[model samples]
Target: MHNDDLSRFFSENMAVDGELSFQQWEGKVLDFAQRVSRGNCKGLALVSSGGTSVPLEMNAVRFVTNFSTGSRGAGLVEDLVVREWACILLHSESAQLPFRRVMDNMDTERFFTELMAPEKSSAVASIVGTYSKYKTRLLLVPYRTVVDYLYLLRLITVAVCHRAECLRTMPMVLLAAAAVSDYFIPRTLLSEHKISSNDGMTVHFSCVPKVLNVLSDIWHTADCDVSRLFVTFKLETHDEMLETKALKNLTLYNCDLVVANKLQEYKERVVMYWRDTPGSPTVLQRPPNGSIESLIVDCILRRIECDATGGGRS
Candidate 1:
C-alpha cells in the first residue's frame, strides 16, 4: 500500500489553478512513463464484493445470498488467468468463500487438522481429491463492509491510474458487479434489546454513500484517466418493465454499459437491455429460455469487449 503521506504530497503539489499537478512528480513520472513506453506495463484485474448483512426480524425467515457467492466473479477470474491476464480478486465476507465441490461434504475442523499435520493425511488427501484443479493468478484484497470496499477501491484506483498513465497504457477497466447494500442502520438493533409487544420500534433509515457513483466522479475529475471501457450491473425484480428502470439507473450512474437483470429472471434470463443512450436500446443478446451461467458470462464479456473498443460512453 502507498503511504498516506504520498497522498498529501500529491495534494500539495496540485496546480495553482486547481488542475492536476502534472509536473509535481516530473522526474519520477517521466521515468515511469519511459518504462511503460518500453512495453513493461502489467495488466490487472480487480474483483471486489460489497458488504451484506441482512437485518433480522423476530420469527422472520432469513435470506441467503444476501451478499454474494462470489461464484460468477470467481469463475470469470479463473478464465482471465487462463488467458494470462494478471488480476486481483477482492472479497468482502469469508463465510461465503467460493469453495470447491469436494469440500461440500467434508468436516471442516478435521480437514484443517490434516492440512496442518507434518505429513499429508487421508483427510487432506480426500479434500484435495474432491477439489477442482485451477490456477489462481490474482492478488486477494478482502473487505468486510461497504466502507472497507470504498477505501480499497479508492486506493487501488489511484495506483492503477498512475501505473496506466506512466506506462502510456490504456486506462484500466473497472467492473461494478457487487450487490452493495443501499443503506446501513446507524445504530445496531441488538443494542436496543427486546421490544415491548405493545410498543413497536420504528427505526429511522438513512441512505448509504453510493460507492459506484463516487468512483465515477473521481475518475472523471482526476487528471489520470481510466480504461476506454467501463461496465456496471443493475439488478431489479420487475421482469415486465425491468429494461426501462435499469436504463434510467445506468444513465444516472454515467456508466458506459449497464448489465441489468431481474431477480425473477436469474434462473432463465432471456431478456436484457443494452443502452448507450437512455432513449435508444438494443436487445444485444438473449440467453436461451432457461437457466445458464455461461450465457450471463458471455453477455457480460461481450459488452466488456465492446467498451474496450471505445464505442460507448463519452
Candidate 2:
C-alpha cells in the first residue's frame, strides 16, 4: 500500500466511535510497553485476536463479521504469560479472553452458583490467582470495528518503536491471529442512518488494505535494534491450498513465519512455514492433553531463541 493511501485511510477512520480517544489509547499502550521494557520478562508479544465488524451504516445497527471466537489467540496469550513473557493483547470487544475461557463453557447461573458454593471456592481462587499473577505482564486493549483494529494495531507498533532503546535487547513478536474483515464500507460510503428493513438492500464494499504489507514494510523497519519477528495466519477451507497460501503469505508479507490452518481441522492441525527453513513446512498436531496454541508458542519462542543465539537468520 502506498503511504498516501494509508494516511487517507487512517485520517478518515480514526475518528469513528470508540470509548477511548486515540491519544488516551496511545498513552495506555506506551505505558504498558515501557513497563515491559524495564521488567525482566522473557520477551514481548503483540497479539491480535477475534474478528472485526464492518458497519453497514454510519449508525451501525447492522454489520458484517466473521466467525472468530479468538480461542487461538487467547490460548496463545495464556501460554505466553505462563512462560513469563509480557503480552499486549489487542482483541475484539466480544472475543474470548485469556484465562476467562476456562469457565466459558458453563452456564452463567451455574458458574456463579458453583463459585459461591464452598466446594468450588478453590476453583474460583485458582482462576483469580492466575489472573493476578499475570495482570502486571498482560495489557488488554479492546476494539470492535475494522477501523478500530487497524488504528490500535498501528498505535501499538509505533509505541514499541518509540521505546526501542529500552527494548533493544528483547525479542519482539507480532502475532496476527485476528480474523479481520477483507472488505468494509468506508465512512464516505456508509449511509448516515440505519437502512430500513422494508425492502432488500444492496451495499457495495471496498477492499480493506493489506495490513500485513504495512506492518512488514513500515512498522518492522523502525530505526532500532529491536529483534522484531512478524507472524501471520492463513485460514483456508480447501486443504490443497493451505501450504501454498501459507508460503505465499510468508514471502509476500516478508513475515518470519506463517501459520496456516484449515477451517475444518484448525483445532487439530496447522502447517507452519518458517522463513529461515525454506521449503520444509512443518505440520503441528494438537496434543491430547494440550492446545495447539501451546505448540505454536513453543515454536515461536524457539525460533526467537535461535536467532538470539546466532543460530538463525540475522
For lDDT, the strongest prediction is 2
Model 2, 5-122: lDDT tens digits are: 8768888765544525755877777777778778889888999999999988887899899659999899999999989999999999989999887778568897888767767666
* TM-score on alpha carbons, each prediction: 0.59, 0.93
Q: Could you tell me the lDDT of residue 259 within candidate 2? A: 93
Best by TM-score: 2
> Tens digit of lDDT per residue, candidate 1, span 1-314?
13354344334422243322222333433343344345422334555544454333322232223466555455545445444444455566652333342344358886576557788666556445433332333455665544345555666655555444552244444666677766644333323344445876565544555556656665444453334335566667785467776766576766656666676654444344444455554343434552243454455556555556777642
What clash count goes with each model?
2, 0
TM-score of 1: 0.59
In model 1, what lDDT does residue 184 have? 47
- Give the lowest summed-lDDT range of ten residues in model 1: 56-65
